[model samples]
Target: MSAREPLIVQREVKPLDFLAAGETASEFKELLKSLGIPTDICRRASIVTYEAEMNTVIHGGGGVMSLRLEDDAIIIVAEDQGPGIADLEKAMQEGYSTAPDFVREMGFGAGMGLPNIKKYSDKLEIDTRVGEGTTLRAYIFIKGQREE
Candidate 1:
């Protein structure tokens, strides 16, 4: 991780890969811990990572998840080539979910992904197209930089 290059960790997420679901989040959290980031921020980043990872797996058909540690914040980016979210507003609602029956049966998609992501991250941005794909960027500002 060169200062000029920035510290970024990227991982590929496979569709329906329940077995590997939370791995990226766990690894990212560990990385944060190793860097001595605040516990709360680490937890928040992990939450964002897991939600993004799950969404990529269940709906994205596969994509890339990356963690970029910046001078003032930790950024989590999830990008997928799967069908994009048709209704962005509805998907932001806590109980709205497009996950299949099997996914719900497995105790995964209870909706809440975007809602929780919005809650945890200080800032969130999403760029999506109907057939192209979706890219979500969530930022957790370091201490002293975040607003109350």
Candidate 2:
């Protein structure tokens, strides 16, 4: 195995189904804790995961978000269908949101989702195609330790 390979543990959840508003963040935090992840890291991971899950529900009409806990990193993969991002750069910018009026009324369309995920993660990769779908893979590294 390569040094860069992640020893991954994966979990897949249907958008809005497995993660409802009141339980998503807490469930994720618990999962991280069960895996021996630190509290601070769990908080960041939960935030990022929740944002991605909401995006999948609101924009993609529901999809799957996979969480992977590796030896030295945490990886989150969110995949969704149709209405791929038109401008990734613009989407990554804070406060640039295309959320519907309803979502905006719900006070969640500040366009900080992607930017926040990128901010808290060590690496973020987004794959999207117009009229098709999008896939976002993010990695958060464990501090002060290198995994072989």
Separate clash counts for every candidate:
0, 0
Cα misplacement distance, residue 106 of candidate 1 (Å): 0.7
Per-residue alpha-carbon lDDT of model 2 for 1-148, expressed as tens digits?
1123443434444543523733666677788899788888888888888888777876776776667767778887778885999999999999999888878887777899899988877889888999898888888887764332
lDDT of 1 by residue, 12-57 (tens): 9988997686778889999999999988888889999999999999
Q: Pick by lDDT: which candidate is best?
A: 1
Worst 10 residues of 2 by lDDT: 1-10
Best by TM-score: 1
Per-candidate Cα lDDT values, in order, are: 0.88, 0.75
TM-score on alpha carbons, each prediction: 0.92, 0.83
Tell me the TM-score of model 1.
0.92
Point out the worst 10-residue segment of candidate 1 by lDDT. 1-10
User: CA lDDT of 136 in candidate 2?
Assistant: 85
